[model samples]
Target: MIAYVGDFGLARFLSDVPQTSLVGVKGSTGYIALEYAMGAKASTQGDVYSYGILLLEMIPGKGPTDDMFKDNLSLRHFAKLSLPKRVMDIVDPVLLEEAKVSQGSGNHTNTRKRMHACLISMVRIGVLCSANSPRDRMEMKDVVTEMHAIKDLYLGVRIHQDEQVMSQLSGEDPSYLSYY
Candidate 1:
């Protein structure tokens, strides 16, 4: 029995050697950035775009190459079109059910509304990270910050940033942003 206690990420990350620009089609088709397909240099933005796709896939339970996508349809577009409103329609049923089971008992409608707000924020992050232009995508630090905020909101546990709990909290009647 052998146990590898650490992550052995691809050696490409360790090797600081400059990769040849315009390398032909290096990554999986769906995850690869459009700029890469057009023979541009590999970049951090490309990785961010792929991560966005991955996040959307987990939420929606849809593969990038799912057959439902045709006539210029794409996983990105499918998710984008469902954002803010119609979001629950596309969320993974099992995940939604689990959410309903956990921390959902106090006023069903409000609970669902809170959950929807959290999910909408997450989807917006995904969409921002996967924008068609590399310049439009989020930087990794911003991504981490936003994700942590979302996590704090979802858990109902305050993550004190500057001694302030930063959930959609304003005044009385705690408002989840989705209600607006």
Candidate 2:
């Protein structure tokens, strides 16, 4: 890994490693896409799949090779099954708790909505980038655009509405807000 990093100056391999049994260059299992494993011609799609796996791993604080996964369960499969509805269960407990505490104490519906949107966007991006079919994966340019948008939201540069996050800390859900 160090050798590749030093060569490319990339923190990790974004280009596909040759599948030859010769010395040098070996791809890790689980992270490698089906095409790469099948010894097909390499493309940026393979890297997108790997990046998707990496992003998916961050949400649950688990790896593609985690022992808890059994049978047909993979990190991608787990993420696919636990989105939007049960996402809270899959997210790291500390992050989930922090979201709840922020929403609860801040008592701001806009902030809560923004947080949900941010998480959903992230999970959706990961899933899209890591789709089994290369055709289904997002292009690197699109990924960069989405990532910038996410960063903007994360930095509190609100995109949708100009409403400020309420400063008062309380437990009450605002009465006027009706989310449907």
Among these predictions, the greatest lDDT belongs to 1
lDDT of each: 0.66, 0.62
lDDT of 2 by residue, 97-147 (tens): 766765565536666656655665677678887888888888879889978
Q: Model 1 — which ten-residue stretch has the worst lDDT?
A: 1-10
Clashes of each: 0, 0
- Evaluated at residue 8, the lDDT of candidate 2 is 18
TM-score of each: 0.74, 0.69
Instruction: State the displacement of the C-alpha of residue 176, model 2, in Å, after optimal TM-score superposition.
Output: 28
